[model samples]
Target: MTHDLPYNGSASLDALLDAAVDAIIISDDEGTIVQFNSAAERLFGYAAADIIGQNLTTLMPPPDRNQHGQYMSRYLNSGQPAIIGIGREVTGLHASGRTVPVHLSVGEIKSGGRERFVGILRDLSEQKKYEAAVITLESQLAHADRLVALGELTAGMAHEINQPLTAIAAFSDAGARLIDNDNDAARTELKNICGRISQQARRAGDVIARLRRLSQKGELSKSSHDLQRLVQSALQLFDHEVRRSNAAIATHFNHRTKLVPVDEIQIQQVLVNLIKNSLDALAESATEPAQVHVHVEEEDEHLYIIVEDNGPGVDPENEPHLFEPFFTTKDHGVGLGLSICRNIAVAHGGNLRYKRSERGGARFTLSLPLTYIG
Candidate 1:
């Protein structure tokens, strides 16, 4: 016998449930599928005739299928529930044998003196991909902001280092001329001047290299590279920035010989963001002798890099939304750096995240797969 829904409020609720984009399914306590909506049929590649009255376990994969009954029985008997009345992520078996990721909300319902469990399932594959894309866009913006900050600081740094370089250059030329005249005393003095010139030139070159790395924007280039070497190369690129900010740096490398295939430029971009953020955090602290540490470790199939700073740490209030686009703790920050770092990591089949460091500062960790080796 068919029973009509209650006329006023109940009818509207039924209509809303049926119209939802998510698929809805109702099953009896015996594990038989009783009601399947149009969306459920379309999503699972199954017709109502094929599913109705069939065992609900057919739509769940191996372990989940076997565990389903136990879970339902436990919930019913103990009144202690796991997924009931709560939204959860689950894998749904499709008729094509592929598993689809879904968000499910399950609730017990009573209709016409009968009890049933209704599940509302929403597909999450598309939404998850879109979220990843948005993260990438935010990361790019953060890198851009960093470049802008570096540009603003470049002129002062250049002037500060140039004076000694220019003086050394001039004095070294005069010293060389004296050496040409063949006077022993003058030649000795000239040699000292030459030594000073060589030192200063190397110093200037190091500074220029750091600036180039920070400001350079280039296309990603993929290659098989040693993880340790890549970390060192990125460190060299930011050496001057670290020193200029008075941040003491340290490193702990776990893999001296592991190799991975990745986009070198993109990975470097992520490293730069991490290092720069650490430096910025340390620079703001009132404490003396600011410090930052970078650690690289490789596990069976993943390379993990952690960059940490010793500072006041991220504001506790902002932790939940730290990786979100347009979120920043610094007054001058545009909030894109970490976001972009996350994107680059994800593109390389990894992830970037933030947490409290043992040193009491914010720590950023990058976890990327060792997808290539040789």
Candidate 2:
């Protein structure tokens, strides 16, 4: 039976090996191709007839191909294995000259006192391409959200600068009238008005500078900053939006401490989104006092900022989908704010989440990495 087994056994084994999803290859003691399965041909973009007798090095790239012969020789002479019976990630050269990433497990087999190596390969090309596509889509969505935020900001910004601009023009006219009247008291009052005019001009300049910086979408510049200061800065960004929606703001920060290490502008962007969401939620509420509360706390190795509103909370069914891109409950919302906020939080090695507030409203919390303090 042992002598008769060789004829049919080989055919059955080859058929079974061909059925596997992963590629299988067997090489002779001299590292020449001995057997190639159907999956191997499909994965390498080559026909079995084309590679059956070729050197195994044909599957490797430049440096790896050069080293493979020496590695095999050393293993054969010393009886010490380098990759046998172990799985490893390596690059493979496809017939199309493309390099493919693969996880390979090789085993050494002995037959008629000669050595052979069988390799099982699992390709990563499809998985890698899917991951790249997801990342690209996310980036495009974030960009769209920023454009929507800019549109809303433009309206608020007009209001923010108009008040100061009007004050400057009125002050300049009064100063000119006082100069013509030639009265000392009126002239002094006019000088004071001129000073106020200059102050307002400077405030408008500051607002413009902030807007310009936010519009550029600069690369993240990280540093240690005061969390309290960050919150105050972000409030300025949303000043007009909150006022137009009639949302009242309350803040709760631990006065004793305020410090963290992070990208200041990015964190401020997160705050602006959270505050805007709060204002939107409050606008939809029928409550007498539309309130938004911002709280910041520092706990071991992390800083937490919570923005809560006394507004209509999210639907229970929509809770899981809140952070998803292009998901929104508002008519004018582009649905990118929360998603961008979460992306910024994750990029900062932190997290963002939404929950029900104690006051029966929506609460968005941003947790950030803190500098390690001894």
Candidate 3:
């Protein structure tokens, strides 16, 4: 049923359809292809002569092709549409047997006692490929970031484990002396020594676990996690080192219990790196009553994980390179702590940046997008 439909006063309707960017296809009430534009010809690799008068489902994949007729029948019978105004993402079959991702929108037209449905399809193959490439790039950057952090972590772990090993050695000597003495208090001393050894061993193991988390390689595992809990755990892991450095710590929570969806392990590494950098700054500075403060607050629909130090702030000259890869002021890392943290932050659709603390020290802020919780 070809109509002499007019477009403006000059352009023919066929010319307009052929000029359109999106593929346009018209089907009758019975779901037979009535018309196919040049764009549709290019999109599905089908000629208008071959496509018209055929079942419209020929362009759809298996299940959609099977169910489309029934859906159209239901729509016609009920005068209701399953998907009309809004578009849907579906797989379309090309004439060359290739499956393409497309966004499809359908519009209904009632003219001269006839009902016609028009479909506009947008090819999403390029978009899908681009997204895949971005994901792969992010994964690679994360792996490299972790590896750089691991280099610095190695020194920290060695220095960290030495204390626990020394304690373990002392406890072993104490247990042996208690056994040799064989006094009534010997039993209590032996139990205490055994407990001390277990504690020390666990301390060393904890360092290894934290380091492994950052250094492990794989696809990102993103999920909803409690920010407060992560902060607490990171601080707890550094408890002994903080105490050894005689640094006082304080924390403020929002009480709103902000939960964020992210790669928790990677984020935890970020927090640890920030804290470690702060500790390094504190150890090198002459600030009295060294203090490290962590605050978790929400502002502007963002969750901010902030680590601030009262130690000397970042050097004015090195500010720009602070987040640069392989830029380190220390003997251990390639300065990957800040770089990786920023990478993780960006990948999570958030940000990690450094600011000047009121105490004239470096403040690292990790801001994450807040999710809507129902």
RMSD of each: 18.6, 21.5, 22.0
lDDT-superior candidate, 2 or 3: 3
The best candidate by lDDT is 3
1-374, model 1: which lDDT tens digit per residue?
01122212255565675687889887877667877777888778898678877877888888898999898888878988798877898889999998777899998876666557889998877876666566556656866776677567667677857877887879877876787777788878887888888888888777766654443344345688777778888786555466356778889998654777788878887887788777777777875778878998877778889998888778889988877755887786767667667766776778998899898898888997776422
Q: Give the residue spans of candidate 1 off by over 4 A.
A: 1-21, 110-115, 132-167, 179-374
Model 2 stretches with alpha carbons more than 4 Å out: 1-9, 28-30, 45-50, 61-63, 70-91, 94-103, 107-116, 149-158, 212-374
Alpha-carbon local distance difference test for all models: 0.76, 0.80, 0.82
Q: How many clashes in each candidate? A: 4, 0, 0
Between prediction 1 and prediction 2, the one with superior TM-score is 2
lDDT tens readout by residue for model 2, 59-169: 999888999999899999998888887788888999999889898999988877778788999998877566656755764687677677777888888988998999999
In terms of lDDT, which candidate is stronger, 1 or 3? 3
- The pairs that clash in candidate 2 are none
* TM-score of each prediction: 0.43, 0.47, 0.47
Question: Between candidates 2 and 3, which one is better according to TM-score?
Answer: 3
lDDT of 2: 0.80
Clashing pairs in 3: none
TM-score of 1: 0.43
